[model samples]
Target: MSTLANETYEARVVAASEPGVTFSGALSSEWIKFRTLRSSWAVLLAAVVALVAIAGLIGYVTGSKWDGQLDPEDRVASAPLQGLFLAQLLIGVLGVLFVSGEYTTGMIRSTLAAVPRRLPVLWAKGVVYGLVTLSTLIPTTFLAYGVAQLFLSHFGHSTSLSAPTAFRAVLATGIYLALVGLLGSALGWIVRSTPGGISLLVGLLLIVPVLLEVVPGQWAKDISHYLPSAAGASFYSSLQADGALSPGAGLLVLVIWVAVATTVAAFLLKRRDG
Candidate 1:
């Protein structure tokens, strides 16, 4: 063939090799879609406001106490989780909606059509939710702590973030939110319906504890510690002080839950159709 013909052939091959975009680029596209959603912003703002309000109340009450025996460290450590239960619920729902909303609105078909490999879509949403959860949790936690400390100071019972346990508790709480969001995303993937997934999540968080309490064995309490919400909430040192679970133990349990949830979600995604 002539040199011109060879050059034309090479150009054609290059265009075919490029196809469209890389997997990472595809993932970025999903992230952009997720960030633009109104629910994402609303849930995140709710988490922050709730955290500050609840923690401020806890700190304010402790500051006004007449017992004169309350431990400031314990109060400070526990302050981060004051609104965690409520915040986690919102975060979980947001994570679920991130994926299930797509399914409900028939957007997942478009997503899958663009990226036939289904797992990447899940992975991208997981990454985006984790980032968004972490971003919201960090600032919300610190602001909550700051507000709490402000009220506590007026009563001469104050705390500082410079303390070792204070810092650890803050870090753990924020990380736990991200992990919980990811777990919710996984459950959302497995369930694929908004109401069903939310119901399952609420069951996991609330009903399990009630069931455990009704049972009649020490094993029940011990095993309940392994549940995601149970263990995750242990990040709140106030609750941990109640001997529910140690901080390290809580972290381990949460990691196991996330691992199991993610694995199951991946399997279901591959097996299920869009």
Candidate 2:
């Protein structure tokens, strides 16, 4: 009886000594997985390069058009941001892979086995990758802005970052991309396939806008401005796009879009298999 009691106490101590699962641990795990993946870093680098490179190219062309003549008021609308459409494609796809790639490699089963509750894994992926996306994209956006303005400065056509519209356009562009990255991550949870998520993202951002333009109705015209792409664009530069919402309204619309996508994904995640 004494031996049995000693063994029981030993087993209890061992069990207590083992660490239990926690949300913070899950977050750390997801971060490690993200940083270790070559594709994640590669996509991030590609986004940085694409945005900065394209902005510089557009800036050079815009400046060169004036043949070295200065025009203080002839500035283009957010020329530094011209490259973000392409960056969106790259970053959005990476967000999709944040979830889908695990399933493809069968690692999700193990992840689920560890975090049986499941939704925390989904939330962690979005939060970690979203934060990573925001941190990287914001600085990169500013860098691209400076690079573009350098080219514009050569022709004395550069707009000041302190200018009211210029600050909003640049900062809003960064936030817009961060939300787009979240949108892509949410799509990954909903579809659970990288290709499918990518297709949906492209359809929503690129194809829908084109289709809306041809629908030939006031409703379509108004609704198009609320879609993720146009809404995000308006948040940065309502002055540039026709039928754009005010910056505040456009940002609100975009937040709704992202929130809805994530909620749908969460509902499906709770109901479906890993």
Candidate 3:
């Protein structure tokens, strides 16, 4: 072929390949990486099992002695979703590993090379992980609720899904967990160290809340409601606890936290060398 013909062919090829690193491509890449990780599957399975087991235990124990031992208020508020406390920790750790594992292994350099624009990688990771968490956990939450209610029904204490806020509460539990997973992913990207990311996540969700309790009176009450875990808890609570934000407000607060973390991660990702 002549030089002009060869050049024309090369230009067409380059143009065709230029779109390879697009947002959709990045999302697909991230999804593959996420699903291939053995640790990811293990953590997800563990979260589901723990959620179901804990809820079942609560149901069984409550139902066994419902007539005389259970309080009326407790029966009414019995969501058996305490398992989520454990699920959060497991899923959060999975999120930390999602990014930090790649960093620790030096895989991030290649990842950035493929998606030089940088921010798409962050967005892809956040969206993929969040969707995975939400899809898996939402159904699990419903199953757990069903199993728990089955046991509780023996004692005439089961609440219906049609009960006020019941369906919303179940749905919100999944949303809260998905947000938590994304928050953890952002922390992982920012810290780039497994231990560091996990520590920060734990402190934000658990330790900080405890530390705030040391503050006296209204100050603690005023501040604690905005913490990530507290805000998330409000979503699934049939009745908002005193000093806690309402469900809508709580969801907004948690979204802000996720957004802030993502923004910081994206900034650092662009500014720092991979």
Which candidate comes out best when scored by TM-score?
Answer: 3
Work out the TM-score per prediction.
0.88, 0.91, 0.92
What ranges in model 1 sit over 4 Å off?
1-14, 17-21, 66-76, 238-244
Query: What value does the lDDT take at residue 109 in candidate 1?
Result: 88
* Candidate 3 per-residue lDDT over residues 79-161, each given as its tens digit: 67778999999999899899999999999999998889989999999889988999999999888888889889877778888
lDDT of 2 at 85: 89
Angstrom error at residue 25, model 2? 0.7
lDDT string for model 2 (1-274, tens) is 7646546554455457678889998999999999999999999999999989988987887888865564543354565677898998988899888888987889989999999898898889888988898899989888898998899889887777887688888888888888998899899888888899999999999999999999997999988989999988888762656668888988999999989999999899889877
Ranking by TM-score: 3, 2, 1
Worst 10-residue stretch by lDDT in candidate 1?
6-15
Model 3 ranges with Cα > 4 A deviation = 1-13, 17-19, 71-73
Q: In each prediction, how many residue pairs overlap at the backbone (N, C-alpha, C within less than 3 A)?
A: 0, 0, 0
The true-versus-predicted C-alpha distance at residue 136 of model 1, in Å, is 1.8
